[model samples]
Target chain A: MTLGLLVEEAGLFSTVQDLGRQGFQSLGVPPSGALDPVALRLANLVVGNPPGCAGLEMCRLGATLRVTVPSLRVALAGAPPTGDLPVLRSLTLREGEVLRIGRVAGGAAYLAVEGGFDLKPVLGSLSTYARALIGGFEGRRLEPGDVLPLLRHTASSRRERALPHPLPAERDRPLRVVLGPQADHFTEEAFDALLGEGFTVTAEADRIGLRLSGPRLAHAGPPEIASDGNATGAVQVPGSGQPIVLLPDRHTVGGYPKIATVITADLARLGQSLPGTVLRFEAVAPEQARIALRRQEAEIAALAARLHET
Target chain B: MCAQPAAPPALLHDPPRLLLLGDAALTVEFAAAWSPEAAARVRRLAARVAVLAAAEEGIREYVPTLRSVTIHVDPSRLSLRRLQAMLRDLPEGAEATAGEATEWCLPVRYGGEQGPDLPEIASTLGMAEDEVAELHTAGHYEAAAVGGYPGFAYLTGVDGRLALPRRASPRLSVPEGSVAVANGFTGVYPATAPGGWHLLGRTPVPLFAPDRPGRPALVMPGDTVRFRAISPEEFEGLWSAFRDGRADPVTACRAP
Candidate 1:
């Protein structure tokens, strides 16, 4: 039997997101997806779906889900929607049921699919960040009483399957960054100052970017740079005298001075950090960053492969 | 036939180059300076590149920004070096022919509660509020891009007279459909969110609605926009009509 959960009491910022919708940024759309890719992958893994399967990314306050399927294996990760602490709660969902999650303690939660959620993949992806208004539930956040039509799967689930172990959450620290092609845009001391100091993640943070409140880093001169392409980790410093770390939903180009970019491997870590979670920056070379990312990707692939086999 | 490594390197005019940003992405650089010619080239290259990347697996996503295109591929099925090789085979430095775009006459209600900063903006420009509204609606603007926020179209070609700096402190929430101007540009807020741009008026027309047939974002890149001033009474009538599902926006526009 195959079925999907009906969303009841959709929490603060719940949306159906996947790895991210790519290839549309050039059209001026940001790739809004799961903030914590690893957790999203694991959640999908637990449900015996592909790592890139579409799932719900519940932020701050989690929502209540009524399982419409007779039997389904569901796993919880990240800060449980609301007041639901200690991510990694696994349970067998009964047909015509309700699961209420509390305010997330750390970041966001990932709910995976068994054979992958049977949602229409727009441009080959299913993560809904709602900023671009493209993927998941018609390019908007999940709402109360929304019916999620599940994708049917041939693989039968073995009852009482052991829940996957929890991943060690990296918290409240300086995020590591790699030096950029434009590191010369800032003074030597300013570049160095980024690594040594602590920055408070401001309340102004969102899927588009995370603004930091800290000591002003001095630029070489008047900081009006030409608009250029940006990536997820790029740390852009605009005229406001504050540094903002671009995220998945960030704009494709900007005129701000990008001091550094967080490594791809550490991006998932930065995503899950709660607002007010103090973060610092550590500079790394591009090669080192790539190697680190490759290792993480390999681990994720292995986990995905194992879960899918079951 | 695949071009050989023996092929002589083309002299870098605008220096068509591909840079590996991370493990899963690469950026095709167009130009260092911002110009129409460069922007046109970017649009062309981005369109072509998107076509090429569309069928290519392992290449998860590709987005075209203002001046560059970002390609996001799966590292497991593809590698940074291999993706670079594929791009090298692509024709670079290609020119683009400009195309005609759709035009819209966005109706807005200026001043009073709808536009909170209309008086302040008018005071700053040494003009009456009505004069400012008149100037804003007179210009036919180009939709440079549909980013910054979803369904938010950054319109260009606003007259310099109406240009003003962004507010020192952005309001916590600028009402949806608020027509705003900052730094010589004007855009309408599709949804309510924090904003710094100076408000001029509000439109009842929905710029972004997920439930709509188009699924949010009424305007796309390469579209044209013209604002029309309306009275508060007219605004209320239109607002209620749309709210009650009586208004059907005439979208007689498309990318040409």
Candidate 2:
């Protein structure tokens, strides 16, 4: 019999996601992937899987699973959900065992299994863009009673693996931003508002964008631009004067002006920041942003190297 | 709050601006406004970057709009300044390539249930329904850029006379294949989506399919499209043919 995870509860908005689909942005397909790459990568490393392998991303809430696999290695990370299972450490679940995770502490939870699930990749990824019904398992959220087959069926037990150092999943820190692809569109005072008073994350948060409510950034001329290409974490302010930080599932092009792009190093913080959470921004030079990103990449790499089976 | 700079008159006279987008990408802005000339410039630069991406492992992917090209690169693998220099050094006089362009002829049924906004669109333009349809079909449209949705191309070259602003309030769900117009651009809804455009007609053809062989996008950048009015009967026949896999829009496309 094939091994699988029988979903007892599908949770709020759980979906399988990988690193992202690349090379299709020109075709209007935004790269939909894990919102917090740091946690997902660490979880994968702990499970002795490739750092970017496809895995289950439990958002807002977490799922209850019945393990049908003879032997399965699993790791939990991202959002530090209320669960008895250890986070950032890999452990085995035998056949007939049940795994349950409760409502998440941050905004989301991530669970990585050894080989992910057996599913056909759409456009070279398992990442779900549910709006377009593309990729992931049937390109939609997991429903109750869904059975996701394991990619690898293990016959024997494997040793546990864990990371030596805790990978930071910061939530309260100010998100670092690199200003402009359109910064000049806003008044200089807008910068002060963005970095000074900051914004509060609204309930309208999703994989597509984080809608924030704060002081209006007055436009120099008009709110709209000749719709241009989008980058992940682009903070776009439309005519209403509210800012929406475009995320992983954002449109490939947007009509509003983007004042800043949150740096790569701060995506984890952004991802974990829940609704009503007060968020702040700090402008960094592009060079500085790159250096901060490099440091994070190096740290993650070092941790991945140290990820060993016990 | 976010405000990107306005359309400065100086930007028109100044050289192209290479702006950093976060740490992973850089965008080369050729113009602040959308124009055919700017679109041509964008096409040329995108083609050049495609060649560059082949040689530089750092260049991950690129999305070319009508006025700019945003190239995503790996920070560890490529320096933003070096990439900017490479872009600046490349000659900007390259002709916009139309040699490989395919012009697709689409059949549409105007002013019906699928196009619920047709009456309002015609009345807003102060033209009869047929006159509005005629005006729309009289122009040759080019796919300026593909965004908003996969295979959904922003078809430029709408008849200036037929140009109308978007609806005061967008519909929560615009039907798939609905032909829409707004702010001088025309687009077909690849799937049912929230939209503000004025819908005037409907097409029976599929707009996007991820597993599609060859090019996944039915309409691509620089590709041209022309529409012809069809009876409701024809629309049904085509819809049935599409459902039966007998109609292929790819086969309908020809050399411009």
Number of the top candidate by DockQ? 2
Question: How does model 1 score on DockQ?
Answer: 0.25
Error of 1 at B134 (Å): 4.7
lDDT of each: 0.72, 0.85
lDDT of 1 by residue, A1-310 (tens): 3357788788878888888876555445677788888888777666556777888888767888888877666666655554533344345667776777766677778776566567887655777757546778777888887877776523355643333454556565456676653566678878767888888888887777889988787778767665666778788887766889888878766778777878778888888766787888877665676677788777766544444222
Worst 10 residues of 2 chain A by lDDT: A164-173
State TM-scores per candidate. 0.76, 0.94
Global lDDT for candidate 2?
0.85
lDDT of 1 at A186: 76
For the candidates in turn, chain A alone yields TM-scores of: 0.89, 0.96
Give TM-score, chain B, model 1. Answer: 0.80
Q: lDDT winner among the candidates?
A: 2
lDDT of 2 by residue, A5-92 (tens): 9889999999998888998998999999998878888888888788889999988899999898787888998887665667888878
